[model samples]
Target: MSLMITDECINCDVCEPECPNGAISQGEEIYVIDPNLCTECVGHFDEPQCQQVCPVDCIPLDPGHEESREQLYAKYERIMAVEE
Candidate 1:
């Protein structure tokens, strides 16, 4: 599943750089995760780097954008292919 930054986010600016997928960005209010680009670090890391660095724990799996591990991995591959 893709991760989301909730309203509880402190805007500490830590999660943005930690996202290997470049999914996290500064929203009008809080940080937002682009579901299209989010892979939860499936092909890059074992765990979501943004979640690890987030102090407020505001980042959570987005139920609305639920995806299986295989799907995430596929998305990661697609992203990598585009970059290459």
Candidate 2:
């Protein structure tokens, strides 16, 4: 599944840099995670880097965007392809 930043986010700005997919960004209120760009760090790390660095623990898996590990890997690949 993709991840989400809840209202509990403290706006620490830590998670934004940690997201390999550039999915995290400053929203009008709290930071937001774009589900389209989120791959749960499947291609870059063993764990979600945003969740690891967020001090308030606001990052959570988005049930709405659930996907298997293989699907996440494919998403990561597609993202990388576009960047390249």
Candidate 3:
């Protein structure tokens, strides 16, 4: 599943740089995770980097955007292809 930033986010800016997929971005009040870019670190790390670095534990699983491992990998590939 893609991760999402909760309202509990402190906006400390700690998680932005930790995201390998560049999914996290600064929103009006908190950091937001772009689901289209979020791979839950499937192709990049063993765990979600943003979640790992979040200080307030504000990053939560996006139940609305639940995806399987195969879907996550495909998302990663699509994003990486654009970069290349």
Candidate 3 error regions (>4 Å):
none
For model 2 the TM-score comes to 0.97
lDDT of 1 by residue, 1-84 (tens): 899999999999999998888999999999999999999999999999999999989998999999999999999999999999
Score each candidate by Cα lDDT: 0.94, 0.93, 0.92
Cα TM-score per model: 0.98, 0.97, 0.96
lDDT of 3 at 19: 89
Ranking by lDDT: 1, 2, 3
- How many clashes (backbone N, Cα, C below 3 Å) per candidate? 0, 0, 0
- What tens digits encode model 2's per-residue C-alpha lDDT throughout 1-84? 999999988898999999999998999999999999999999899999998988888988999999999999999999999999
Clashing pairs in 3: none
**Higher-ranked by lDDT: 1 or 3:** 1
Clashing pairs in 1: none
- Regions of model 1 farther than 4 Å from truth: none
Candidate 3's TM-score reads 0.96
lDDT value for model 3: 0.92
Ranking 1 against 3 by TM-score, winner:
1
